[model samples]
Target: MENQFSLAHLTVIDSPPPEMTYLAARAGYDFVSFRPIYMGLPGESNYNLAQNKQMFKDTKSAMKETGMKLLDIELAKIYDGVDPKSYEPAFEVAAELGARHVLSSIWTDDRNYGIERFAEICELAKPFGLTVDLEFVPIASVVDLAGAMDVLRTAKQENSGLMIDVHHFHRSGDKAEDLLNVPRDWFNYLHLCDAPVEIPSSKEEMTRILREERSYLGEGGIDVAGVVDRIPNVPYSIELPNIKKTQELGYEEFARRCLQTAKDYLNRQVKT
Candidate 1:
């Protein structure tokens, strides 16, 4: 099967949607993921493509010019009291753009409430032909593959699934063998990045590593190849967010290097 690689918006968070699409295409990525909903965190950049008519049109034009597909749009955080219905506009834009997935996470401590809300969001997203992918991060309520599976099992929504980010999988103490227990169909796509083998000393450091210090595939100690080998065939979203590298090389060159390195790493994995 041909590998489908996507330029995750987080990889170039500072770039607008139009530039992201153009750069992804120029860098030889097969698809691009967008972040239409802000993560609601301080210092985070977001774009409201659904409401920005001109930006939306420009992004569409860039995709047309580059022949790049829309892989997904993020992010929907299922926190307590945050209405999933409020995300309808973002879903509308994703559907109009033919995106395949929505990256989401739960922030509440109550597992039951989180599951219910996630299910509701899945139902809401069904009509838009979008899969709601619940990403498991160490800082979030659903912190591991098993926790994410618990929600997926209870929600029982066909349109809901798990989205594994390699950094989170490693930091959460999840093993490559653990992936064997998951149903293959439960995975829609995955986020790929690399990090140092040493675990962070504190939550603050971990957060910094995840958001700003990740390395390209094969550049750090993460067993990206091992994890990739275990997962079923699915598109990969290159999500390395190295602020320093981006500063030195610029977004365009940084993106190109990311794609090339990922392709090279995967090719070596196949050969081995």
Candidate 2:
């Protein structure tokens, strides 16, 4: 089967889920990864679809009309003193929308605590048929491939796996060789994007670039082909978030370019 592409919400962060669904369809995406679970980050909107009944209905309507599937829902973070049960509502909403995965990350530096919380998250998402994918963020406590693998191993949950975001992997100084031995089942999907080869010196600089200005595939410094070749051939969720380009090109156009660049880049890989 051909690889499916998902229009990740971060690519069009300003658009609500309902509108994002339609936009994804128009932009030729097979699915969408939404941020229904609010994280309250700066410039981030709270899209609490769990409580917003009308918005939920609208989102469902859009999904039905566009035939767009909910690939996943994000930010089910494993943090200090966090209650995994608290995300039950978002899990319910994601299940209702037919999402197959739940995105999570480790925030606390305590390894045992991270494992416990991540396992709890997996258990909570189990009944909903959601697989929790642990992403390693550079600024977060789980800062590399080893840390992410450790959490999954200790969590020991069937419903848990790892999510490799190319940007984060590169930022963490992890190489494509590092992924070769990882179990294929651990990779449910990938966060596809590119960034400048130069590593930022400060965590704050990295955060700024990650949230506001990721490059399109092949346009930046990442050895995307090498990285992609190591992982499972699963859906690629386009998570390119460029604030300036979005402002200049508008959401629809920016989204189209995101998809196009991705397709072109992947095609080149095939030809080579």
Candidate 3:
């Protein structure tokens, strides 16, 4: 089977979308995830391909030249006061770029409201052939796999599912066996990265750890092998972002190392 390993935009957020695509392709990634919407606060690197015609053209050209596909576009936060319909323009851009999924998360405590907004977003995305993958992170309102399932079930959207980011899965105190309870079809794709066995003392520390200090496959304390074994036949987004390492080695070298390390880890898992 072909391994669909995608390079997440967060791994190289410093590069523009077009440059990121080219770097990911050159580094042997099959697909690249783009962050058209910035999930963080203001002053973050948010690319508006819908408005920037030239950047959009360059991104499309890069993908065509490198034969790399657009795996997903991200950061669709479902929160109170945010109009889900406003994201239709972003969805349109994702559809035009041939992205198969849109990554999103819940930011509000109101489960009923969260479900309604998520469903609305799914409804908006469905016509474009995009699946809404709800990624549960520690800092988000839906903070675990179970919470993500709760939202997905309540939303009842045909084109919606859970996105298992392995780091968040482990850090959130979830077990590998928990995957057994999740419907196989509920999983659309996954993000892979390793982290220390020791949990961070606080949410801020954990957020900082995940955003800037994640380790490559097999280089940290996470049970990467066990997690890989549990989830079968799904595309993986290598979301490890180590700012220090990237600064030392540069994006190209860092991207190459991440791909090779992950490939080695997965290959060993298959043989075992």
Candidate 4:
């Protein structure tokens, strides 16, 4: 089987690295998603692409130390209501790092033109041979599997499709069979996380800890194994937003735990 493990940048939000690369590598993650200017960084939450020309290079170096690869660079503002043009730098960085994909979200309300506009951006990436996958987030547009598929169909591009996030499955009230029905080819990545259905808080409450209060594999209420079963074999990543524990346990331990949890889940899945 293809070993597809992804390390999400969200877990290292407070690490003291001038960049996010080292934390990923130290935790034994294969690939990770990075943000040129992450979402909730000080004042520039929206359209937070900084002028740090070396951010990409620094991040690349971080990967070198840890033997980790960059899977995608994030587009955080796209979810917070920033113009799509702001995402160009992230795409540029992903290309520069020799990454294969770029991930972002399109709010449900933006369906008017979000997907179409995304298709237009695909042209820019083809030159670099990168495929873009829009993450189906519950709080963002494309809340459910069907809605996300609509965007993919509208784009009609081989490179664009849905990135099934486990949390969103519960948020959108979708089941495992609903996920299995997805055209297998349309899936590019799997974002793994499990949380309770307690109306998961929004960024309005606290930016960093959204997925943190979650439990490990089979510990939470989410049907994570069932969700994983539906995706076939694809690149898997974790966004364990541990609210309080990360402050105590630190990023490296957090990354290790997340990876171990994922391994446990995948092993059980293989047995199943």
Best by TM-score: 2
| Candidate 2 per-residue lDDT over residues 78-102, each given as its tens digit | 8889988889999999999999999
List the global CA lDDT of all models. Answer: 0.90, 0.93, 0.88, 0.68
lDDT of 3: 0.88
Candidate 1 residue-wise lDDT, 136-226, digit = tens: 9998889998899899999999998889999999999999988988989888899998999888979999999999999988888988877
Q: Judged by lDDT against the true structure, how good is candidate 4?
A: 0.68
Lowest lDDT 10-mer window, candidate 1? 38-47
The per-residue C-alpha lDDT of model 3 at residue 180 equals 82
Question: Residue 244, candidate 3: how far off, in angstroms?
Answer: 0.1
Per-residue alpha-carbon lDDT of candidate 4 for residues 128-164, written as tens digits (9 for 90 to 100) = 6778777776656677788878878878887775787
Return the clash pairs for model 1, or none: none
Stretches > 4 Å off in candidate 3: 40-43, 270-272
Q: Using TM-score as the measure, what is the rank order of every candidate, best first?
A: 2, 1, 3, 4
Among the numbered candidates, top lDDT falls to 2
